[model samples]
Target: MRIKILSIAFAALIVAAAFTFIRKEVKVDVKSSQIAWVGEKVTGQHNGTVNIKSGALDVENGTIKGGEFTIDMTSIDVLDLEGDSKGKLMGHLKSDDFFSVEKYPTALFKINSVSESKQADATHFISGELTIKGITNKITFPATVTVNGDKVNAKATFALDRTKWNVRYGSGSFFDGLGDKMIYDDFKLSVNLSSL
Candidate 1:
């Protein structure tokens, strides 16, 4: 009877250990995280910052299993201009000619899968569905992710074709006879996130 009781206790300990290694959810520190964007045209380029509304990451044994984030489209700010110039550009970007922030105030990205990266600097390749202006598209990019104690940090930079989400304001692909006014279809986004 003594030996049987000891075996049962050992089994319970093993089960507890297994539970510790299960997936854990970490809430993102939105105030500390940042997302920057850059859009270029034939004449010049404009860069600005956007805010992450909320997010969380799923981690298991130091590996990121999944994650998702929401972007506040109404928080877009232009960094390269000042005063009226900045406000004008920001207003234009949030209008129907661009993101139409009044109708779709937020965007989202949900991770579908993650894999070990072949790049020397990046730690993983993240494949996910990105939704903007109410349209969702699959995008894959390399990211550097670090997990330490109860914290996680991830950084990545990638470019997406704006036309994919139907933001076709001054795009040459849709309009004609505009030489220097054509805005490039692809815009770049740089993301840095920290989880609490």
Candidate 2:
């Protein structure tokens, strides 16, 4: 009878240790990480960078369990243009017709779940809520997650519909006969996140 009680106690200890390993959490390095954005029009495309204000990752035995990050929308920049054109385009992007940065200065992304990916090139399949201009939507994408000692690197490329967040400036769905002036609804974002 005493041996049976000892066996049960040892099994409980093993299970507790396993749970402890799965509860590790890490904070992301906002300065070292970045989110690059691409916006396309019928005539051309523009690319730029946005700053990550803050973020953190919940890691379970070196696998990403969940995470969240905030974007500083007011820090948006235009990399493909220069001089007056750059300033003008930046202004328009922050205006009421676009993000309205003054009114909505930040965007947010929160991970709902993450699963280990079976693909060769990807490490994780992540599903999350992306909020822009106070509108939230679910986005799922595959990312390459690399863990080296204490450092973690995560990268992903995905697209989001600007109209869904109420940024409909030249959306073809809202306007007709725009010809070359119609901007595409989806914009691409390439994210590279580094965290300890």
Candidate 3:
């Protein structure tokens, strides 16, 4: 009887280990070159990619595995703000009046809760924290993910207020005699992530 009971327990342990070994993890594909911020005829591009980082996950019943999506902010864009007058514009953008890249050069987003409302399309509502210019804010956005075999793709769009980060240069401080138009208050980001 003792031998039979030990054999059953050993079998159960093997099954549990196999299940853990086959568990899926969340993956990310970073394409930093795909980010841009354009306004008032000013546009900037990044070097290399945006760090395009990823993190661990827990998959439950084919769901997200866990309720977390994290990113590394040090992987953010360092705009190539140099080229003729446009280069000067980029310099201005990086100055203390604008992005203050010297002090705050990274932007971060971390998803805390992800809820699935549909099964066929795999639509999700992800809520997370966004940090910029040393300020942390909570934001919730929509992400649509499609899975095929071991590959996955997710895309989303969101906006942020430049003023919130103290990026106030040329925003409204323009001299009237110089006669300059103030840039808009909001900045938008479009993201498409693919994982394997």
Find the 10 residues in a row with the least total lDDT in model 1: 17-26
Q: Which parts of model 2 have CA positions greater than 4 angstroms off?
A: 1-15
Model 1, residue 90: displacement in angstroms? 0.3
The C-alpha local distance difference test score for the whole of candidate 2 amounts to 0.90
RMSD of each: 1.7, 2.3, 5.6
lDDT of each: 0.95, 0.90, 0.58
lDDT of 3 by residue, 101-186 (tens): 67776666666777875644449876777776777788877778665655666676656677776666645543333333456556
**Residue-by-residue lDDT tens digits, candidate 2, 35-103:** 999999999999999999999888777777788898999999999999999999999999999998999
Which 10 consecutive residues of model 2 have the lowest summed lDDT? Answer: 17-26
Preferred candidate (lDDT higher): 1 or 3? 1
Which portions of model 1 miss their true places by more than 4 Å?
5-20
TM-score, prediction 1: 0.93
TM-score comparison, 1 vs 2, better candidate: 1
Query: How accurate locally is residue 21 in candidate 3, as Cα lDDT from 0 to 100?
Result: 41
Colliding pairs, model 1: none
